[model samples]
Target: MTHTTLSTAQRDRAAGVLLGLACGDALGAGYEFGAPLPDHTPVRMQGGGGFGWAPGEWTDDTSMAIPLARAAAAGLDLRDETVLDGIVAQWVDWAKTAPDVGVQLRAVLSRTEPTASAVRQVAKAHHDRHGRSAGNGSLMRTAPVALAYLHDPAALAEAARLVSSLTHYEADAGDACVLWCLAIRHAVLEGELDLRIGLPALPADRRALWEGRFAVAETSRPADFARNGWVVEALQGAWSAIVTTPATDATHLRLALDAAVRGGRDTDTVAAIAGGLLGARWGASAVPAEWRRIVHGWPGLTAADLLRLGSSATPDLAHAQAESVDYAYLGDVSTLVRHPHDDGVWLGAAGALDALSAEIDAVVSLCRVGTKQVPTRIRHRVEVRLIDDDDPAKNPNLDVVLLDTVQVVAALRAEGHTVLLHCAQAQSRTPSVAALYAAVHRGVPIDRALAEVIAALPAAAPKRFLRDAVVRLAEANTDSPHQGPNTEGARA
Candidate 1:
């Protein structure tokens, strides 16, 4: 428990990265419409318009990022119907409001653009029509794809190129997507800032290896220093800034903000994408909290919840869901451990499915304000919750819907005798309620039971995200705390 390499405090602090990215995103979002910033705050909005978005509201940038991640997490292949469907569905959500999506993207999404297939249709179209297009827009939202395919650089390139063509049909745009995806892949997985590794020098022959390519955008000229209108310039700018910056944790992030604020037509999006890449390099933790507190993602997707959710859900990944081992941190401890809850270690895909299903079942049951699970065989359902100290009426979205839980649990119980108990992470909060349930049904001691869990997972089981969630669970109960000698009182 007292490992010298990382203290509990350090572990908790490192867990802040994911939160950091969302904050940066939300904070920067304030200026997305080219809004003016008060002198006190940094200016991230510039150019023709302001983001007009409220704090925490992400634009097409972050929204598009998740499904790509989902697709990648599911498989490296963007061609997979599941992956493509996921991507198109997210885009469709955006099109619902801002229907005037970028040209190529709109066509692909509509499936009216004469695409031969999903894999390289967009890119090929650009090659055929635009002569050569390399737009930074393709690069901006490339992180999720990079993250999903962190293990496969070439695959990352292909996917990035494909998605890029959805909006941009030029080779430069395609290359921009490939290069930026490469950059983000390095940033997120390799903790790299330099473009030299996977993204070769621009206007170079790197594209020939994948497929014969040329950067023929009129906007790009060797002497023009590609800027404002050229995707290559923005892509290269991000690369240069990320690589050459002072290495201050958020330095690259700041530069990205700089890009968006003054970045003219595509300012905000470019800023968002650049910040994402930079944030990934900094492990998402380096983003400022002020910003993350404000950055908003949609109901099912967002920076705020994704990584944290990932922390727990990661352990529950189905076999087919994992891509590569990437990196594992025993939290703040310097030593590395095999990543648990990953598809890699689970004897391939089948083991993953079994584990994921089990984990989801545990989550569904354990965190229920209410839940539904068809418990096969003898089924035990446990629900634990802590009421908000301030208000009983207010509900955090994370809690399960009460009616749904009741319906499922009721039906299951009707099928057979069901074992169900609800407890908070802290025994005290859950105790009174648990005691009530115990009187009515089978129940276990709340306080004493969780203590054993803590002891068992002193190093291994309670990953940081899971541990924090437990703390929150205990917090909701507010009846007892996890610190000190009293931990064993419940005989747990």
Candidate 2:
């Protein structure tokens, strides 16, 4: 297992988790605690809603997932949320609609101190029912944690159970939680259905049923799988289709989605939730526009926005209520997006100037982002550019294209507008070195460049290697850092 970094798109794979989580929640939320599906949904299941639209909002399942994600962004362990209060503060300030919390979970979130509450409270809640209680809630919302701890399944299941305990207490319920995490783990690594991921972990009874279903090859003669009331059955059914359905086409996914929606009971939700696992594996192409359009709180955003948020290891969207992304550049205006999108954000002083020049009719917003242990800070600009022309560190084919970027605000004291600095989310030798030249040439005070970054960065060339990389970038860019301030200044 190589420890290489994930590419922008590869890292953004979890964007699917976000999208899938939200979509599943919104769609399933419509009918939470509703009447069971028709005794024989075969008829309605065969002819289902177009996008699982019953009032596509989200539920406790999805809502529960939000805290975990915010907790992750804050670097607080799920087992401990000393910083969760800050998250609660955000929720209190912006989230107008309260979540439809599960009975137990509602009580959990109702706690006054996020820090004091997230402790054993999460796991203890499910202790009595960890093995018996099985519900779709945990299975539905565990994707985010699964991706975050891809290398660790126990941690992933622990997160699912911890969260599930807040609301459910059943043996199968806990077991179901395990299946969902496995589904997501498989999705992240292969992005394709991987029955093996779950077969090893499912309970004997559930696993037996799943195997029974898998052994049955006829679509007409549905497998002996049970959809009675367990999360495992639904999850198993979904995964079965994912592996055998060969329905990667958006149309197929769309059709299957409608089938899930109208089948009523857990069937619709089962279909919708499982879709997240499958759709994520196949990528966005497998999801349909109709489903996205009808989903509640979707924010009507674009793929680019999703990708940008994905690169940063966080989804800064309407639900998250980001002050910066909350607004937009309507016309000739501009906005900036600054943050770490995995590999590490490479801030280019010179590239910032060039992007401003590129803005003939586009609106841009520049923002800043903090490092791993820091708080969330908005950068000023997020332009798309290659760090270096000849830096071999980049794989042109795999990088996130047309990135939403940010500026090195500190570089402003020197070149004002003309000064250039290069920054990237990918940690690459060429890109980091490229930043050196762009920073120095764009009048980035040489001392400031070294002091502000240099040693603090992993790729910052060792004193010996730093000189050549810096000189090379300087020689390539014609602009001088010491040059006069531009008419516009450095303000975005």
Candidate 3:
């Protein structure tokens, strides 16, 4: 139970489960209430549905889980009155504007009750009136309970039911939450899911029931196993997709997620439930970078933001020192990368100068309008100042700035140093400079250079505001008698 006993693998899985849940939620966000995605259609996060979210934006599932995670990070027992009260308060706040809300959940929260008992009473009333109130509501947000109590299965199982009972009073809903939490915890602690770990925690009859259900699930298809509104069927659906998918390698992880999301109705919540366990089993690196860039949640929390929150809940999860990764190459010309590539200059955001320079010979820091000298650990530093606007129309000096950027990067590459051109998010300003650098120094046309950079960094979409400036810069470079013929040269 000590922090010293926690392993790196445990930490990554804990982080992975939460992040994976968000990734699935975001991925399936677009598919909600829509027709089934055709087989082989790439499942990128597009972000428009009944909720009308921006692409990569998670829905109610992750939004509701965030408060629970924050409470767990604060070290409150999830079953405690204070913790449950705080969680429901957050739910009420989120529900006020949430684009999607479960019928039972909305009915319960609408009563303005913040206590677990009050919520449970309301849920029980709904169940009595409606015959079946065992919605997937509780199971969708239960991943964080696994992380909070991962070191103790009995505590996790108990806590999972308590949280579930708040809005899903049915025993099936509570039981499903317990099983899913145990599965997530097992994956985090043992590097894979082993349902036996949770078997002893259930009552004798429920235990026998789940064991048989799981046995049957081994051969069940997702469509048949998981029904959106029923908690037990939802778990069955999630586990079936996971058990049947061939997640033996990176390709399989993608395949597994594809299978999960393609389940159709309520795809986001089900895939999110399945994804948390899958991510816990496979580790965070199993997720692709393009997806990682866009995964975000309500209240403007990004993937990195959620990762830090997950890390906070699990104290043993070691975080790299700010900007600990060294220089890395995003492309042959230097594009999207986590570490600065060796043997190159780094063109990065304002804060990235230190991390970039730590491993390289020099750095070019881009800013909106002015420059400043910064003390650094590395030997060399260059400051490039330009208007930060995305459009060329707003910045009269954009042509001059682009020309200067091209010259600076050309000078660095001529000296045999790799250069990282990075703006914040590396989506706009950085790639623009790199495209201009390619056009001027390598004699490539501006359009061709821009096309190549876009191809290399799929996520780094250059801002269109720079179009006029880029064309002018390309035209000026084309007219130059000194334009080089080495179009194949690397200078990103």
TM-scores, all models, native as reference: 0.51, 0.50, 0.68
**Best candidate, lDDT:** 3
Candidate 1 vs 2: which has more lDDT: 2
Q: How many backbone clashes does candidate 1 have?
A: 36
Lowest summed-lDDT stretch of 10 residues in model 3? 367-376
Q: RMSD per prediction, one decimal?
A: 15.2, 14.8, 13.4
Best by TM-score: 3
lDDT of 3: 0.69
lDDT of 2 by residue, 243-359 (tens): 444453333444444444433455444655665575456444333332333444423333233333333334332232332321112221122222222112333322232244331
Off by over 4 Å in 3: 1-4, 318-492
With candidate 2 superimposed using the best TM-score fit, by how many Å does residue 465's alpha carbon deviate from the native?
39
Tens digits of per-residue lDDT for model 3 on 127-229?
A: 8888777999899999988888877778889999999988887888888888888988888777767755777878888888888888776787666743666
Native-referenced Cα lDDT, model 1: 0.42
Q: Considering TM-score, which of the candidate structures 1 and 3 is the better prediction for this target? A: 3
Every candidate's lDDT: 0.42, 0.42, 0.69
